[model samples]
Each structure stands twice: as C-alpha cells, then as structure tokens.
Target: MTTHIPAAAKIVADLKARFFPTPTYRQLQLEFDLLLEQRRANLRQGRQQEVRGLLVVAPSGAGKTTLVARVLRQHPSGLRMLTEGEERADIVSMVVPSPATPKGVGLDMLEALGYPLRRDRSAHIIWQLVKTQFAQRQVLFLHLDEAQDFSRHNNHNDRHAVISTLKSLTQSPQWPVGLILSGTPELLDLVNMDAQLARRLKPVEHRPLKTSVDGGMITAALRQYAAAADITLDDALCKPRFVHRLVHAADYCFGILVEMICEAIGEVLLAGEDILSTKSFVTCFSRRSGCPEGLNPFVVEDFLALDVRRLLQPEPGPGNQGRPR
Candidate 1:
C-alpha cells in the first residue's frame, strides 16, 4: 500500500520541520508572556500572589491552548504539570465547559485538579478535599482553557454560584490561586449575567490580532514570528488578510500560528502541481475539510453553528421556545 503525499502536505511538512514550535500571533504575546511569568513564580513559592486570570476572546483557533502548553513546558525549572487522573493536582490546567455553570465548571475544575470524583462524594466533601490539598501545596496558578463553554442552561443563580466558587479558590491569601480563562468574547456577556462573578474574575480581556490596522508592536511581532518560521506569506498574521480568514474560520482565537501555517501548507501540498505559493496556501486554508474553494464559506458557517451549540448546550426545550417543540 502506498501513502500518497500531496504537494500542500509536503510544503507544510517542510515548514513545520523548520518551525516546530511556531510563534503565536502578536496580539496574545504580552498577555501570554505575563502568564508565563505568573506560572513560573507560582512554582516553588509559598505565599506569592498568582497573576490574575486572562479572559481572552477570539475565534476558535487563536493559539490560546498552545500558548498555555508552551508556557508550562518552556519554563526553566520545568516543574511537572500533568492532567488530572485521580489525586489532586497542585498546579493544573484545563478547559472550562461551555455555558459555564457552577456544576459544570466545578466538575471540570475537580477533574483538572485531580479530584477523585464520585456520585458518592458530596459537593461539600469535594470542596474540602480540593481546598485542603491546594492550600497545603500553595499552588497559585489554575489555567482554564475554552472557558466560554461554562454557559449554563439554567438561571442567573447557578452562574453566580460557579463564580463564587472560583472566587473562593482565591480567597485565602495563604493559599490563593490565580486563574487563567481563555475563550470567545461571548463570555463577556456571560460575565455580565453574574455581577459578582464578573466583579471577581476581572478577566484580563483580550481581542484577536489584526495584521492590517495595527502595525506598531503587535504587527512587528507577527513579522518577527514569520521571519523566525521562514514564512513569507503576503500578509503576516497581524495583517487583515490573514486575520479576516481566521475570523471567518472561527479559529482566530485559541488556534495557533503553527496550526494555521501547517494547515495552509497541507492545503498547498494537496493542490496538485501548485507550488507552495502564499496564494495556494491561503486559498486552501480558506476552505475547511480540503474541499473546493466555493464551499469554504459555508463550511466555516456550519462550524460556527456547531461551536454555538457546543458552547451554549442549552437545556432541553422551553429555552428553544415552541418552534421545535
């Protein structure tokens, strides 16, 4: 059996080989940098205040998760950060549920922190265990990715509880835990729903990168990243041409430069005789699933719709009114 390699895939493989860990887009650099510092300091510190959480809102693929992973791995001390299995995680990270509610968010938090969750364990019991271990360890950093998923199908009351719980995690200065929350801007409205949660989270707001309009620091950063990656796409990620496509693709938020360029490279490779030109790259990237060009827009729309459903996860009926019922 022969494994056929497309031209685009070959180009992307070449690009990835050159830039294994591609630089993140410029817009998120500063915040991400600060986040790195916060994580480092949180390690081995007994009573230091953790950096406040970041509430980054952008399209789906803006490199947010990759950024967090990069920061954790790149640290000099190299303290181990593992996913939750059973035991508590002193310093752990994971994505929050869409339509974030106390229950959903709490479950994710529990799982992320490595709590031995069971139907048998009461919420009170779980809280005690988590709080005790965290306080003892002095774990100041808690990174929550895809937090926009915390949207609750229920009422304001549920949202408030979830917010309060997060706040409680940071209440004791002796055992304070700074959070990092990244997701879509709709989370802003979700925050508004729960005044106290909004008040406490004080989310360090973030917007998507722009390659065309802004050209000072952020633009320069993208150019630098492109240079590092040895990529000469007509528009840097900081430019409008690239950013616009990302926004439409709905991956402009948590997705990373590495993923985009690599995907584009794959697209270019799959383009038969087309060389690895930027046109081929972007044209291929414009479409999802590697289909023809015309179908790109609709595919993106379908994905966005899926994202909404996944994010909102509204409770059964009534919320949907009578149309479907």
Candidate 2:
C-alpha cells in the first residue's frame, strides 16, 4: 500500500521550485551582467591593461553571496583556449577562509582551480603555484566570496599579504584577472587598507531597507511570491503594517525576508489553506523563533511595539561565519 502525503508537505514541495526576484535582486543581476560583459570585452581585445575589479559589500544575510552566485551561474566555469594556445579558466570563484591568511587563501584558490595539493607547501610556495596554474588556465576573472574574512581577526601583516596578492594578480606583466570581492561590510576594512586598492575596485553596497522607503517594494515582492506559489495573501497580511513588521523581523535583510515568507507559505500549505494569512505567519515565526504567541510579532495585534530582534538570530560579528564551499 502507498502512504498518503500530507497536503501541506505536498504544497511545500511544489513551492520549492519558486524563485521570487525582488527589485533589489533584479538591479544586482543587471549590474553583474554589465560587469561580466565588460570583462568579456577585455578578454576579446586581448588587452593586458589593468581591468578594474568590483567589491560588493552587504551585511550578513543580505544575500551578497546568493546574488553573486546567481549572476555567476550565467557564466559557467570551463576551460577555454587563449590565442596563445594555452588553456584558461573562463571564471573561477571560491570562498575565502575565516580570518583568511594569504597562505590559506592561496591554497583555497589552487583547490578551486582543481589543483592537487599535499598541504606541505608554504604560503609563498602555494602562491607561486597559484600564479603558475592561473597563468596556465588563463583565468580571465576571479571571484572571492565571503572576502571579509581577509581582514577578519587578521594582523596587519596578514591583511597586507592578502591585499598585496590580490593587487599583484590584477597588475600588468602578471595574470591581470578581473576580480570580484564579495562579503559583509567588514570587507571595506580590507579594501581600505591600501588607497590604491580602494581606487582599483568599484563598490556595490547592499544596505538594509527602511520600511518607510521600501514598504511598497516589499509588499509587491510578498504579493508576487504568493501569486507565483498559486496562493492568495490575506489583504490584512499584505498591508504596510505586516510588511514593516516583516522587514524588522528579518533585520531588514532581503534574503532573510524571502526565507521567512517562504517558510510562512510552507506553513500555510501544511494547513491546507489557499490563502496566506497572518495566522500562518504567526505559526511560522513562532516555530522559527521558539517564542510564545505573546512575543511573536506576527501573532500579536500590537506587533509594532514589539522588539523582534529578541526573537531573531543573534547579530553578526566580524567573523560573519558562513559555510565553506
């Protein structure tokens, strides 16, 4: 006999396929495409000039990593032969280790490029290998995700090592690969270390939205996601009050907000409901936060007076710990 699946689980399974692109996501996508195209042009021109790099900074949970990954998906990494009859990477991306040291970062890059390592080499040795391998691959572009780790808990010398290495990679008579540095705001410290480094990279900041300014956009995003999931949202739950509360609850993070909405939708699906109501959201928040109804912003009528931070994840620190790829 076949086991019956719960309606909620079935609906949530269907919702898994949905990808709601908010206004911010759209803007970032465009910027990334333009940057990628510009780099491609440089490759075509065979120009050895110093191709400018991009640094994207955002708070933890602001979706900096996800945004970059989505954009990079359009340019899949593979081997391509240069005019010089040498194999080169179309694009190479990797996450910088926590409290990233120059040597550790170098090894990470080598690993990302599919190089075998015995872990017996020094930072200097690993870097030499990296330069050689990168040259062989003719890597046109390199993306360092969670790059804030470069400066996180690092001494001045360590920080400088990482920065100088990055600079050398983009300088003339070397690889001259276009760089993409993405991480939390702490990444600015790494960029600001060298005035020249700051000048070389363009900054793309992702700041949290204020409810008063972004309420309409947030509301639209919520409605759009519900519609995509083939469900209706309650009119009350779609109002600015709910939107503001959500923004606050999510620490004004777009990524967190999207996840919270998806979780709420899942809750609604589990209940076999056709409409996303505040009650469903209340359940979602309560479950995520492990808070009673009185403290849950989605459950209480006077949610505006409640401090949602108490119920959310602990604030991010300089470490900004994330999964390693």
Candidate 3:
C-alpha cells in the first residue's frame, strides 16, 4: 500500500485505484462468518446425521451466494469448482448442475473431477467416467449452489434422472461424506417434490434473523462490516428506522452481506464522504445494487416487486418445520 510511486508505477496504481481498488482474491467476508462456522462445525463433528444435509433458503436479498462462496473458499475439504486447473489431482468440485439437461449437468461434474469427456463420447461414457473419477479423486463433498434452478428440466424423465443422480451421489462409495445444497425456498420444494431425493438430502434449512439476534452478537457482525468499509453508524443514526434498516441489511445470510457491504461502502468512499450518511445507507442496498456506482434502481425494483414476507417464510418442509427447539 505504498503511496509513493514512480511515473510508470503511478499509472498502474492510478488504474488500479480507479478500477480494481479492492483485491479480487475472493474469500469469506465478515458478514457470513457465523453461519460458516456453524456449517463447518457440523461437517467436522460428523453430526450430519441429524438431517440428511443442509438447505439454506432465503429471499432475493438474503445473500446466500456469498455464504456459499466463503464455504467454498474456507471449507477445509477443498473448494471444488468446475473450472479446469493443473494442480487439481485432489480437490474436485464439479459444477455439473443445470436445470436444463440432467445428463449434461452430470457430464460437467465428470469434467470437473478431472475426467476427460473424450471428444464426442457418449452420455453413458460420461456418466461412468464421473463415477470412477470421483472415486479416484476421493472428493469429500458435493456442494451444489443455486440448486433452485435444478427444476429447469424439459421432461419428467430428466428430472428423475437428476434426482437419481443426486441420490446416488449421497449414497456413494465415500459414504457421501457431505451434501450441501443451497438456493431459494423453491429449491427446497424441488427436493420435496422428489420424496426419495428429500429423504436422501436431509437438507439443513437456514432461518431468518429475529428482530434481534444475540443482541450484541448480531450487532458485532454489523460492526465488523462497518469496520471493513471504514464506515460507522453514529449514535444519532441509531434512531428506530435507521437501526432497523441497518439490522435488516445485516440480517440476510452473513457471507453475502459482507460482499454487499464492501461494494456499498466503496460507493460511500467514492462519493467523497467521510462517513456513511442515511441517504447513502438507503441507496447502497446490495452488491448488485451498488453496481456501476450508486444503487441500481432495478435491484430495488425487483426487491420491491416481491413481497418482503418471503424473507420470513416458515420452513416449507417437514424437516424442522416447527419452531426451533
């Protein structure tokens, strides 16, 4: 972070300052740290037996993607992704999931696990490759994010095929170490649609934050986000509406909130402000909203279009459908 710079260095720094001020090495943000810890502890303790796995569903603004990205980054098991890499003999996260064609999706997973889908190979070949290569790679987990899109199939057969493949994965040779599926409530319902899939997944559903959670704990998370962006809410800013808005912003899935706050805070700074103002606070709602500069009016429009009640929709499944004990 040296400020002094040579002429050539100055240009590079200026470009970076203007375009990529924030480092791009994606990592878990502060907001979703708590939820990440809870999940990691669950996986580590092998206490996954309580439910088949976990299901994290929230409204549009809930920040589920950020949390998933963090777990992908920090999960000790290795962040498996679909993109091809060289040193990928061990960590294999197959991004072979599409609501369109179940077989194609499965093939994508095969490719991610280091299985070469021999040029012009048959679908069966791909499926077999996925099975064997995954075993060879000894992947410990299969986390399918944005799973709600799985319903994008053309026919009932494809859906069943997708469900069957998922079920088989859970009962794999590796004892199906862990299955973490995340998406909106509709995704949870997709699992429910297939009784067998629902039985196998044992989803871990996420709950919304109460009006107040751990009083100081939730506030502490808010403080961390504020600190990250070099912005702090003043005592005067703690009026009922302001406090409620701040809390609500922080309430969504923590990991996402962190990503969102980073961008939102960037807006506050770019505006040449010393501290975040109420107008700034309301304007910077989400990372998407803070795109191309200030909050995009459309993000607010999409959110406003949907009733906020989706944020607090009761768990839609028999699993933990009742109040938490």
lDDT of 2 by residue, 40-145 (tens): 7777887666767888888777788777776665444333422233355566777787658888778777776677677778988898888788767777768899
For candidate 1, lDDT tens digit of each residue in 1-325?
1233644455556655542332343434455456557655665564455345556555555555665566655555564565444343445777666556565556555665656577466555666666676765556567777766655354666656656667677665556666666666666666677555566554443455444543344344434434543455444454555445544444334244445545554554454432334464446444444434333432332333322212223332454321110
TM-score of 2: 0.83
lDDT per residue as tens, model 3, 12-55: 23322321111111222222333445545765876433224445
TM agreement with the true structure for every prediction: 0.63, 0.83, 0.62
lDDT score, candidate 1, position 120: 62
Q: What's model 1's overall lDDT?
A: 0.52
RMSD of each: 8.4, 6.5, 10.9
